[model samples]
Target: MYYIAHRLFAAHDRALAAQLAHHLALKVGEHQVFLPFCDTDEEDLVADIKGRRLFELDRERLRSIRALIAILHGPSPDDGVCMEIGYAAALGAPVILLTTDFQDYSSAPAGPRTVFPDPLLDALATRIVRVPRLGAPAQQPGTSRFANFAARNHAQVQNATEACVEAALQLPLPLPTISVPIRDGSTVYAEPSSYTAPNYALPGRTTIAGVTVLGPTRFEAAEPIPAARHDWAAALSSTRIVVDGSGPETPPGAALLIGAACATGRPVAAYLPRSTYTHATGREPNHRNLMVQYGLEATLRSADEVTAWISG
Candidate 1:
């Protein structure tokens, strides 16, 4: 399966993204295409999604994906797409960065056809394919932005779309196997104490239900930044499972780590006690968001369940 990550917030972007994804689907198998904007097609920002299920749905779909076809554009490329690329790269999957925008970007030594400014983000690309932007931008407003461009440059759009599909078809699927031993006796790695979780104790336990948990330091430097992303890279590879054992609540970092784990096609499980999640009036809801809910292989509520999940 090929996961298509593109800008999804605006109508202009949405149209272009849909058109490109549609063409890619025609070239590849229809079942292979997964786009996050499917529910947002009518541009209903308010009424469409509930409880952030969209994020969970997309992340879940991204799991076990054969490769990534990420579209980069705008002054600042979509942060979500960049993360998607990084996740796919971590899994050692072939990433084809596709761009059809007319923006004049600098050819940095960092990445091929560099679209984004950050060197770290650019380094994730396995290859780059730039579609020649043929028509000029539409000056008028009211659906003319992407619609006019599409209408004026029909040939350009078709060719570019096919070019992207061809690039994707050349790559192998069911990505290569990689083996890394679990560090220590850990069956799962929990969120580190580096980032503060407002509602719960961070790295809640060293072990759950007799299964050893890895809580290695996420920072390599004196500061709290993920300076040691290498540690996570190794930890993720070493462990068979990555877990969000934050009990009552989840930290942002846990969400990020687990999503990365899912992106690598690793099975993950979590134990978020239901009692702690039900909030009183005026208090923030403590339930697990759908992102974690969807990413987890098992949603365990007790220590007893942890061992059983791990054994599987």
Candidate 2:
């Protein structure tokens, strides 16, 4: 049985939460869910003593949960949801974040300006289920109607719920440990060097499993600038080969690393599983561009391909 955690602040959120709970219960065949505001009424003010008690209760509930599913709706997630994510992570629980905001909110936009999930949430999530915006009003005449709205909303909720359940089922797995540079929108120049020979193996014979940028670093609300840069340098220096997991939306830090690798004659590879490529870039990967611009030695399509490259 899985214990799903979610927020239920507004009317629509409550309704969606109920639907999600029902769907998840059906999918798991005997599961418990924590929907905040389901049992308690919203209050504008509460006594300090009572508030403390409520906080304790919420934490207790959070502790018992096996998985956490945070519903994010805008450019930023709710403060409560962020706290919940931190709590769940501290407890070593897998977190699945469902969000409709899928746009790159960075200063330097990577790809299309479509709605994208928050970078920090994407980094922390055990799985991220990106769903369409619920209740998007039809624009044309004869297109907007009560029936159509109801049907569309119901379908969106159902699809998102199913995705959440699938993510929940895959829980309790170890999170991937990757190192990549963080892009800070700084200018990085490629240096010419004589070390043109490729170095894919480290002194101790270590190979990079994958490379991913520190997304949270770009958000001032997420981490401090100094720390984020420190992490980026650490990730780059520690690995033999740096894998580009950022797709075409390469962060400045990752791009810097690519140039550094080229200057030092270290091999850099691109890894884009079909699902990831489609979800991130919303189209087929431009392999030729990645190889030419980034000095990438190869564009890998799967874990097996990456493994082969590492082995060879």
Candidate 3:
């Protein structure tokens, strides 16, 4: 059996967690699954906190589980989830951290401060999986909440849940380390010529062995404009032969950098968001245009596809 720990503050989050637990239980049958939110029925009462029954029960559950699967989202994870992760790690269970939110933890900044995964959790995780967002943003008028939630997250939840189960089963799953480029798209329209490589979030199944931010564009202060240009060129020289995320619709300067990468005879690929593709090319994705203009070997749409490509 595996323990799935997730935040249940929001109604949607609770709903999503239930679906994930159910699907995971079905996939890994016979071995019981424990979901904290799903298993516990007692309301959290502050006045009766001294009883400590809930805490004790949770700890016992944590100790018995073979593995822990944690769902992280938003800018940061809830404090309770963080503690649960720590406790599970201390108990020596394998930890699987999954999220779709990508935040750069390695690079120094050229702009404002940003959030990254917690270093402790990052170190503790045995496997990390990135997946696409579960469902559409807008709610249909007649759809029940569970139906709507299921509709949105069914595919991603199933995929992630299966991966978690595989890990629990001690099956081999590839954890590939990838290099990702950082670009600032904030000024794409305001200063089309200005180029700055801010930071990049490398998403994969394992920790990045190392990340070399190509140029003088460390997380600190920026170099002179010319110096920065030199830095951009330098960064490209150190980039991987197969770049995972690069596209022209990024900030203009960043786009040019990607172009430069393509020009270097290296293969550049992008997981083009619908809006980004529309914004960049002003039309739907045409393979011919993607190749001729963006220099992408392939334009991927999901993390699973990207993973298969990287693993391939």
Q: Which model scores highest in lDDT?
A: 1
List clash counts for every candidate, in order. 0, 8, 5
Estimate, for each residue in 209-295, the C-alpha lDDT of model 3 and write its tens digit. 333222233223332333434444353444332232333323323233343444343444544433232112123333322222334
Q: In model 1, which residue pairs have backbone atoms overlapping below 3 Å?
A: none
Model 2, stretches more than 4 Å misplaced? 1-7, 29-31, 39-48, 110-118, 133-146, 172-216, 219-312
lDDT of 1 by residue, 267-304 (tens): 66665545344332232353544445555677666655
Give, for candidate 2, the lowest lDDT window spanning 10 residues.
186-195
Give model 1's clash tally: 0
For model 1 the TM-score comes to: 0.51
Q: Candidate 3: misplaced stretches above 4 Å?
A: 44-51, 110-116, 133-154, 171-312
Estimate the TM-score of every prediction: 0.51, 0.49, 0.45
Q: Whole-model Cα lDDT per candidate? A: 0.57, 0.49, 0.48
Candidate 2, after superposition: displacement of residue 162 in Å? 1.4
Candidate 2 clashing pairs?
101-116, 102-115, 102-116, 102-117, 103-115, 103-116, 183-252, 183-253
